[model samples]
Target: MRGGSGHSGRLLGEFRRTPLLVPLSEGDDGGLMTGWQGGVRWIYAFTDEGALARFAQSRGAGAGTGAREWEYLSILGARLVDAVIPTVDGPTGVAVDVADEDASMLFPPVVGIVADAYAVDAGADRADAV
Candidate 1:
């Protein structure tokens, strides 16, 4: 458990420092490409263009065309977790490097990963008060 906790801290710090590639929605008014899983809204971010391309391919973005271009915004992980996540309603989290099984990381909508006000498990600390 200690090692796992250390790993989480290291990973979270690394994620906060790295610049993530966030894909934009295809519309005149571009919005973020997000999804819901287990009631949590996830904002997908890739570590690099290769990672993004792999994800896009897996999702069949272009299908038979074999040539699909995706629009993206490069934002630091800190801003995503600190600024963007708060603006979004409900529990929101960032999913990083989703295409790579070994490299993937999930910044879940928990007390440590998000603002206390937005964290799904914000009250967990209080549970220990008893």
Candidate 2:
């Protein structure tokens, strides 16, 4: 499910517990975090082709539709970025970037969770596997 602002820890915890695939980034806005649950994968400030494709497929939207969803997703993404980047502990300066092509892939279970959450938030009657 979607979470409110200032709940990055909780959201990150949920992502870890559920084991969803999350990409963490550090940019001018702040720390950015994006994850995939179910079929839907979200990209915050970073745009990876693979991640975008997966998120689109889960939403049952063509490439075009998926692009549109990014607009809304980015809003939440910005908050996530701000919340987590500062907390990351490392010499990478907290505002690190983890966008490896192979690493971008989400596990199946995590994909399911993301998709389920998306459906619930969108008020879709059911979830669809992409």
Candidate 3:
């Protein structure tokens, strides 16, 4: 248990420090968001690992072909992720786009993208609390 917790921490830290461009692809998780304004396919340039960890966990990758449990990152450099959006009504997750960017450096082979979305409640429910 201790090792698992420590690893997550390490991963979280690594994600935050690396200036990597994570390409997010809407997976089959079935996000709840609806009627968004922009493209769902987004290129989130995050310097925060904690957010990245959250994104990785949300997909429920289920330990792919590897020693790592809950493996999300594929050797191909692109992983599938759920697309969640905050609308006027509430938070919803689905397949979407973010309009292609000229971020050639952020593309595959150079950088890796763990496709996933915001797992936690993106709605008012989380704020309401237990």
Clashes of each: 0, 10, 16
Identify the superior model by lDDT, candidate 2 or candidate 3.
2
TM-score of each: 0.86, 0.22, 0.22
| Candidate 1: residue 16 lDDT (0-100) | 88
Name the candidate that leads on lDDT: 1
lDDT of 2 by residue, 8-99 (tens): 45644444333122333335553334444343334433244455456445646566633443332332332333443334332111111134
Candidate 3 lDDT by residue in tens digits, 1-130: 1333345445433433444334334557533222333422233433334444544455454335652332222111112222212221232222212122221112211111222233232222445444
Task: Give the distance in Å from residue 97's predicted Cα in candidate 3 to where it truly belongs.
Answer: 16
Candidate 2: where are CA atoms >4 Å away?
1-47, 64-69, 72-130
lDDT of every model, 2 decimals = 0.85, 0.36, 0.31
lDDT tens per residue, model 1, 1-130: 1335556677788888999999997778687888799999999999999999888988887556566689999999999999999988888999887888877778899877888899998876576645
For candidate 3, the 10 contiguous residues with the lowest summed lDDT are 103-112
Model 1, residue 37: displacement in angstroms?
0.5
lDDT-wise, the better of 1 and 3 is: 1
Best by TM-score: 1
